[model samples]
Target: MDLVGKVAYITGGSKGIGYGVAKKLLQAGMKVAISGRTLETVQQAAEKLGKTDKVLAIASDVSKHGDEKKAVAQILAKWGTLDVVLANAGVGHFAPIDEMSDAQWHAMINTNLNGVFHTLKASVEALKKSKGYYISLASLAGTNFFANGAGYNATKFGVVGFTQAAMLDLRQYDIKVSTIMPGSVATHFNDHEPSPEDAWKIQPEDIGDLVLNLLHMNPRTLPSKIEVRPTRPDKK
Candidate 1:
């Protein structure tokens, strides 16, 4: 797809992988509307990017239906059309099932799974018109189980299935859908600060580049599911 002049709506675009993808899209000449739960952070990030005219920042909690509608309405008001939707807003809660609190499990399911649904539902009409793309940020945990990661794994696994099924459902309308599952990205996910030890992990920009590549791929060929990981994991 031609990125120039395209308009994209990215959720959780204030920091981490979403911010990196927004920066890449902006550099590619796409107008983007970035949504986050915090208006201050979203605005600050937009300003830092130095393309305010081409970027719209809106505070939105993807877990809520009303928030998703408001964000989409704002984007349409600004750009008149939406070409891409990246459902990257997610939260993580790591704990054994027996030890996990109700709040922890709910938070993960709401943000990581239901949030994607709201985002896609809010953007579907515009995307159908533009024959656009929908990308979801899953995780390697979606396919691999680990101790104390039950909440996160369940959401990601659901995401992978949701994205793949959505791809099949939307393809007839000429809209593409894909999911990216990456391992150990250098980001502040789950409140973990990135450190030098993260050098072996994938960078946010690498995922950004991957999104670009997926967009540029021929329409005849859709790489529906992507799993990316560090070339060299740290040895204990």
Candidate 2:
């Protein structure tokens, strides 16, 4: 698809993978809107990305269907069409099933699982009109079960499953759907600070490039699921 002049909406785009994708899309000449839970953070990120008419920052919570509806409405009001929707908003709360609190499990499900549904539901109509793409940022945890990761695992697993089925269902309308499952990315996820020492981890911009590639792929092909990881582990 021609990326120039396309319209895209990215959830939780204030930072991390969402922001990375947003930056790349902007560079490709797309009008992009990024949303975060807080208006301040979203605006700050927009400013950092260089405030311009091509970019929009909105405060939205994907966990709430209403918020996503409003966000998509705002994007359409501004651009008149939506060509891409990236459901990248997520939160992680890891704990053993036996020890996990209700809050932790619910938070994971609400943000990482239900959030994707809300975002997709809100944007599906616009996407149907444009026959656009819908991509979700899942994780390797979706397929790999680990100790002390029950909550996080369940949500990601659901995301992967949901996206795969959505892909099949949406194909009839020519709306491309895919899930990107990245491992060990250097981002502020799970309260980890990224540092130079974390060079072995996959960088956010790497995912950005991957998203761009996906966008430019042949219209006849759909790479519905992708798993990416760092090439090497950190040496002790």
Candidate 3:
């Protein structure tokens, strides 16, 4: 598929991996609308990208039903069609299952799982119109459970299952779906600041490149699930 002139909507796009994907899509000549819960951050990122005409930044909380509607409405109003939807907005909460607070667990489930559902609910019509694509940013924890990561693992695991089933449901309409599961990405997730020590982890732009490749793949074939990791591990 031709990326140039295509339209994409990305959630949690103010910074980190989402920003990287937006930059790549803009570079590929795709018009992109990006959402963040904070207007200031979203505006700042949009301005820095210097593609005002091709980029729309909206303050949206994907976990909210109303916010999802507003976001999709804004994108549709701008581009008249949606060719891709990247449900990349997610948050992590780390704690032992026994020690996890209700707030922490709910936060993870709301953002990582419910948010994706809201995004798909809002954009499925436009996607049907364009026979577009849907991609979710899951994590290696989706399949690999770890100590102190119960909340995060549960949400991501649900995401992988949900995305896969949604893919099958949408295939009859020619709408493609895929989930990217990356291990140890150098992003400010779960309150972990990125640093040079993160060199061993996959870079945000690498995920961006991966998304571009997925978008360009032949229509007849769908590589529905992808797992990526750093080639080298940081030595202890």
lDDT by residue (tens digit), candidate 1, 1-236: 99998999999998899999999999999998998999999999999878889999999999998899999889889888899999999999887899999999999899999999999998899899899999999999999999999999999999999999999999999999999999989998989898898888899888989999999999999999999999998898
Clashing residue pairs in candidate 1 are none
TM-score, cand. 2 vs. native: 0.98
Candidate 3 deviant stretches above 4 angstroms: none
lDDT of each: 0.93, 0.93, 0.93
Pairs of residues clashing in candidate 3: none
Total residue pair clashes for candidate 1: 0
lDDT of 2 by residue, 168-202 (tens): 99999999999999999989988888899878999
Per-residue CA lDDT of model 3 for 1-236, tens digit only, reads: 89999999999998889999999999999999999999999999999888799999999998898999999999888889999999999998787889999998999899999999999999999999999999999999999999999889899999999999999999999999999999988888778889998989998889999999999999999999999999988889
TM, every model: 0.98, 0.98, 0.98
- Off by more than 4 A, model 1: none
Worst 10 residues of 3 by lDDT: 184-193
Residue 197 alpha-carbon offset, candidate 1, angstroms: 2.4
